[model samples]
Target: MTTSRLEDLDEANLSPAQKVIYDQILSGPRGIVEGPLRVWLKSPKLADKAQALGAFCRYDTNLPPRLSELAIITTGAVWRAGFEWAVHAPIAIKAGVSPQIAEAIRLGQEPQFEAEDEAAVYAFSRELHENRGVSDATYQRCVAALGEEVTVELVGILGYYTFISMTINAFHVPLPAGASDPFPAK
Candidate 1:
């Protein structure tokens, strides 16, 4: 297990502000504090705002679960964020994303997407991560297939997961106890 840059805080030791954010997270779909939240807890206000945005991105987005999970795994793989990849890969599969596709991304290879929507998401996310922006053709393809609102939400999901991947990578956040690292050293 990798040592985190920031120590994980106990609920009892939390300040009043930290306790508020902590309680909010506990009440949310994510009932446990882990991943980026551990680092974000160092700043209670940022933790509150980030968790709210993350809740929207992860749960409230218009993007379908499969597509959202695909984007997350892609972003996590791009950054070699072991904890993120480990957590999301199974969720991606459960959301109907192909296991082969997730495995391919984990190995840094092009995925053979079984659906047009999956291909569009993979292309758009790959372009955004690689080139820092998507090409007009890619954007148009996504819009045509997923509609404007979902496309926008897809981008938001991508951006949010990117932030998550960066946070996990930067802090060297470890996988949950007994969970294996999905992305092993190359």
Candidate 2:
């Protein structure tokens, strides 16, 4: 078994503040403490705030589930964040994203989107991740397709996942048991 890059704290070992945040995560939709949150536990206050933001982006975003998950895997693939990709790829498919589309992103190729909204989300997210900003045309297309509110939430999802991806990468968080890295080194 591969070892985690950081210590994986268990309930028995948690400080009072860490236990509070851990309990909060347990009670949320996540219902488990894993992924970047494991690393975030090192800083309880940061974990609390970030998890709140993440809860909104993951569950309460204005974007449809399909588009939201599309944005998530896009960010994961861009960063080659194995944990993020592994966690979201299945959710994307369950939410109606084609497996082919997710596989294309996994292989670092552009996906062929059958839905215009999916295509728009992909373009908007990919551009923002790769270029640090989206072009006016892409931005306008996203705004037109998703509207200003969801477009903003799309940005939030992208940013939140970026933080998650970076945390996983930085901490060398291990993949779930029996799961291989979806984005292996070239």
What is the alpha-carbon lDDT for the whole of candidate 1?
Answer: 0.90
How far out, in Å, is residue 62 in model 1?
Answer: 0.8
**Residue 107 deviation, candidate 2, in Å?**
0.7
Q: How would you encode candidate 2's per-residue C-alpha lDDT over 1-186 as one tens digit per residue? A: 145688788779999999999999999999989989989999999999999999999999888899999999999999888888888999999999999999999998988878889999999999998899999999999999999999999999999999999998888888876778897766
> Which ranges of candidate 1 are over 4 A from the true structure?
none
Q: For candidate 2, give the lDDT of residue 47.
A: 98
Per-prediction CA RMSD (Å): 1.0, 1.2
For model 1, what is the alpha-carbon lDDT of residue 165? 86
TM-score of candidate 2 on Cα atoms, chains taken together = 0.97
Q: What C-alpha lDDT values do all the predictions have?
A: 0.90, 0.91
Model 2 clash pairs are none
The digit string of per-residue lDDT tens for model 1 on 56-144 reads 99999888899999999999999888888888899999999988999999999998877999999999999999999989999999998
Model 2, CA-based lDDT = 0.91
